[model samples]
Target: MPRASLWFIRTGLLALAAGFTLGALLLLNKGLPIYPGLWRLLPAHIELLLVGWTLNLALGVAYWILPRFIRGAPRGPGWPVWAAYGLLNVGVILACVEPWVASGPWLASVGRALEALAAGFFAVHAWPRVKPHGV
Candidate 1:
């Protein structure tokens, strides 16, 4: 597997762990009343599992398997994909912590915007590779 692919998969797993942890904490709080209103973190947990984990894993696999632009370049332009990775992780980080911060709403909005931009980058990078191969 490629380094990028590994990074994506590992990061996704980490996100999965984080999501589960948050869920467990929520459950614990419900049973013991440790943290009041921990329910607010629900959206963060969902985002971590869905966008941070699932989406990144899918994108990483696509990057690994998709047809390249030329024989010399299997993954096409490297920067855009790297940018997508960075953007996604950063956005997820910001989003996950948003609920606990004072500037949460604004930060969450920015995080969402970043995630959207990351998706756009992935789409643009993957567009040409979507067709069937002649071989």
Candidate 2:
């Protein structure tokens, strides 16, 4: 596995842990009513699990498994995927904080936009790697 893939996967695992922790707290709150403020974590929980964990892990696996060029760089340039990784984490953080701020909607929107852009960057990195049979 490439270093970038390792980083992506590790970050994803961290997000998964955090998401599960929040989810457990939410569930406990539902049963015990420890604090009503725990309800505000719902959006963050969803964002962390969905985008942070799922997307990051998927991207890392994709990066590792995707085909390589027959010539030149094996995995193509590394910068785009690195950018994707950075943008994705930043976006997830921004999105997860959305519910706690007055400008939440806008922040969430920007976060989503950044996520989409990160996808585009990853796509750019992965596009040429996808090929039929033995090219």
Highest lDDT against the true fold, candidate:
2
Number of residue pairs clashing in candidate 2, backbone atoms closer than 3 angstroms, sequence gap of 3 or more or interchain: 0
- Model 2 per-residue lDDT at 30: 98
Model 1 stretches astray by more than 4 angstroms: none
Put down candidate 1 lDDT per residue, 1-135, tens digits, no spaces.
778888888899999999999889988988999778889989898999989889889988998887665565666777788888989999999888888899998999999999999998988888878867742
Clash pairs of candidate 2? none
Query: Which regions of candidate 2 deviate over 4 angstroms?
Result: none
What's the TM-score of each model vs. the native? 0.90, 0.96
Candidate 2 lDDT, tens digit per residue, 1-135?
999999899999999999999999999999999999999999999999999999999999999998877788789999999999999999999999998999999999999999999999999999988996357
